[model samples]
Target: MTRDDLAGMLGEQTTACGPARDALMAGGDFVVWDGPVPAGQLARTYRMRLRRTQRRGQPTLALAATVDRLLEAEEELLRIGQIVAADSSWTFMLFLNAAATEVLACTGVARIGTCPWTWCA
Candidate 1:
């Protein structure tokens, strides 16, 4: 779907905390990726990589830092993309800088079940 489409969808969603759509839109244009791999799988793969790096004592990926911010709500993040499964079982939202170069965070939403993966890069 296009950015405008996604924005409209987000706008329709309501929350007790506030207008999540505003927070989501503040990041500028949204980018959507079409691929064979599902979002959950992608997140799992990235998480595995992160574990490997942590085991080796290497600096974590930027995505990990972004995920930390997501958990802590340290700062408002920019929304950049969305990854939805073909069966509509799950969706993953990608966040990054306004320029859309560096990825800031990725969060997944599951329709039929709970999603356990949230990865960043």
Candidate 2:
């Protein structure tokens, strides 16, 4: 996916993950993890991409703004998955793209209506 596509999927632009996002935006090669792992697991490593964008210091000025935009984009991407995605990959991708564990936790709570931490599995 392109940076704009990821941004659109994530909701807003990122200041930290800018370079990676820019890479994707500019049509750079990317490797998507599309295995059977749950959303939580899938997102663990990918969020680093967002962090890097802020460190790059040009496009996405503040990590907060970048985070805000990413959350919105994630919501949008999940909503879209209600149709196009035949498997968990779509949600997995966004979950992976998310900036923080809190975002994913909130998303899980929204999905299950309970704190995931309280669950045994």
Candidate 3:
């Protein structure tokens, strides 16, 4: 999906630290990788930033949905989640509905298992 599509998916704009978004826009960077291990698909490498201001010094929260990165390498999967969460000062991921994207506070869905990697999908 395109960046605009992703924005619509998450209901926010995505910002990449470098040229990740630009590269993906140019093509070949957002290809889906599928394999037998995870039985899912993932975008190869797409750099993005999603920013939300905190309320009076409160930390901002953002997240990378597990389903979004389901097919990525283990490290990459973790990297995406951390990047989105940490970039927003740990406010991005709320762990609701056991979904990586089911951020806490934002979504009222209760988290199920403790697994942070794959649960929503």
Candidate 4:
């Protein structure tokens, strides 16, 4: 689905995953796609893309640190079955997005991936 479509869907889904949905909206820079695995494929699930918008030399170290901590602390919230992970590809893509992860390694930003627990199955 398109970004606007996803935004509307998110708006309607507040009760489904409020914290995660709110977190994503608060992020201000994210895109929605049908899948994140295999680079380009459609699925019943949704995938979000968050780019590191901060300019270079802006000092993302603190954010990175926080992301790392969250990732460690919220392991259960972020966990998903192999089938879901494989179908969505977001968890893997987020882990593999080295450049983005480099800046967001320790910030609330990483929680964006963990926020959508509804995806778990």
lDDT of each: 0.43, 0.30, 0.25, 0.26
RMSD of each: 14.3, 14.1, 14.2, 15.2
- For each candidate, give its TM-score against the true structure: 0.34, 0.26, 0.20, 0.22
Choose 1 or 4, whichever is better by lDDT.
1
Write the candidate numbers in order of decreasing lDDT. 1, 2, 4, 3
lDDT computed for candidate 2: 0.30
lDDT of 1: 0.43
Top of the candidates by TM-score: 1
Task: Encode model 2's per-residue lDDT on 10-110: one tens digit a residue.
Answer: 33333233333333444443333333333332233324534443354322223344344444444332211111112211111223433321122212111
Model 1 stretches with alpha carbons more than 4 Å out: 1-67, 71-77, 113-121
Task: Indicate the worst ten consecutive residues by lDDT in candidate 4.
Answer: 98-107
Candidate 1 residues 1-121, lDDT tens each?
Answer: 5444455554221221112234344553335543333334444555575565456454322445434544443344343465454554444456544444444455444333444233321
Residue-level error in angstroms, candidate 2, position 53:
16
Candidate 3 segments exceeding 4 Å error? 6-17, 35-121
lDDT of 3 by residue, 30-108 (tens): 2222222221312222112211111122222222332343333333322122112212211222111122332111211
**How many steric overlaps are in each model, in order?**
3, 17, 11, 8
Worst 10 residues of 1 by lDDT: 11-20
Residues 74-94, candidate 4, lDDT per residue (tens digit)? 422221111112223222112
TM-score of candidate 3 on Cα atoms, chains taken together: 0.20
